[model samples]
Target: MTSPDEPHDVSSGVSSGAPATGAHGLGPHVVGTRVVVRRLVPGETGPTGGPAFTDVLGVAETWWPDLVVRREDGTAVTVPHALIVSGKPVPPRASRLQHVPGGEVQRRVRGLWPGETAALGDWLLQVSPPHEGRVRRRASSVLAYGSPDRPLGEALAAIQDWYAARDRRPELCVAVGSAEETALRAEGWTEPADFAGHAVAVQVGSVARLRRALGASPHTAATGTVATEHGPVAGAAPDVERVRVSVTASGDRIATGLADLRGDWACVHDVRTDAAYRRTGLARRIVAGLLDEVAERGVTTVVLHVLTTNDPALALYAGLGFEEHHTATYLGPPR
Candidate 1:
């Protein structure tokens, strides 16, 4: 992943005889393994651009004339040789920064959708009557349950008893990878009849980095950014269509966005652009707009749920530095 410099040559590139000064000094360790590189700023770091040395994580793919690398989320960035400051090899994507399904991540995610929540041992139960056709909220929810260590049978029984009290059927948002398949099957917790074959992947990213990345995309910057939510993200699901566009100077609705803040963590939802305006980087602008809006309120982390089968959505989110948190599958509790 790295070659030597200083006392020795780290030349993964051909010998130019010189160290490639001015606009060509990217040594040679620019390709192969993952590396974090810092770029130099001319005058002041903040005002000129960002920092004196901005560190980016990605696998190096080119060297010399321009340094190119691919980010973990499938986005590629090229650094002009003039901006090269220093770089080093980093380990591959082994441990993920996104929290796992059964732990703190699950708890925080459940807290977002308020329903009466309870615990069957370590498992979480959410009971809320389906309202205004928000079926996800209405159905009884059992989360982080069905693991081997936890009592799957006890959880199933508890789910049945709890939902029965309210005359509702118990449904589950399961991270199957974390649970025992045998136990789930033995308990008869079958996948929902209307299962959409596809699943949703939770993604997270730093507010600041994403904001900068969004700024870097020329297409995204072509459109103006608008932020339309301030309080509790408009009560779960607000009238996204009715929300006024504050940033669009153009008469046409090029893009729209809204965000909800819960303490330091926030989720950006209902970001959309007119179908006619799809490929114009409107999606990036909307997301950046939401993140930029929330960053003003001291929000640090951003999250979203995208369908696993939606390749375009996955690529879009990943390119902005969002890492997958987990994928969830739904099931009907023991029938």
Candidate 2:
């Protein structure tokens, strides 16, 4: 009898893709659509005819080496991987897979606490828990077998099963690292495109020197201060409520930056300059000064995020010795 949990076709009233009659005196079972079984040859010496391998499905809570298949009546069949027969491929639904935006990706991430998704372009990628200290994701059209003895067909089917459960396409998947990459490539899975690497480095010793360099620049000194009818002020004058400012050469008030000291790290935040003084290397000077201040405080590292598409800003940071650590991608359901 079909299990109550399984969905049945209402019009035909068939469980899984099983037919009305079959050789086991039960019912005609559709080969690939309804139930998948392991095929065992008579001379096969392995666990080919024993049980299904549910572990291959990659379900979060499922144990390893267990068989999992649907019966004609819609009940789950648990057997060794060796017992199942390889079936034809069932194409995935194209509408379910989609490319999501960064905002949507952020919303989804916020919906789940402590879980993160990175957005790179329009693709949002969710990483699985760290395996061997490095995070990994299930690549599309790839299967991970715990052992080398498992049949290739069964491994492929297991990969398909994972995609079905996730409502995702398996053809566009990728695995990280040389080992996993090698395994997938061996199974004929496509590899991701090679790209330049990125890194982030901090200059702990040059912070003060950088600050002096900027402060000594005539352009920075002239534009760094507020101008009054009397004369130009050299540095910012601190006030209680808000930093006081005077109108500038371009009728804009001079802006200021503050150093946020935290546990051997100084974040140079709230950097601003007069409208007429913009792009005069003032910001870089401020950052350098801030870096110097932080280094004096025993800080050795600095980090920040910039939009990947911001070419000018990225170029500046690259020149300053920062490198890309990782790239993020955002994904959404198909439109």
Report how far off residue 201 is in candidate 1 (Å): 1.0
Query: CA lDDT of 192 in candidate 2?
Result: 31
TM-score of each: 0.62, 0.29
Q: Rate the local accuracy (lDDT) of all candidates.
A: 0.58, 0.33
Task: Give a tens-digit lDDT track for model 2, residues 52-160.
Answer: 3321111011112333333322234454333444432223112111233223322222222122333333323332333234322221122221222345446445545
What lDDT does model 1 reach? Answer: 0.58
Q: Model 2, 230: alpha-carbon shift in Å? A: 29
Query: Where does candidate 1 clash, by residue pair?
Result: 130-138
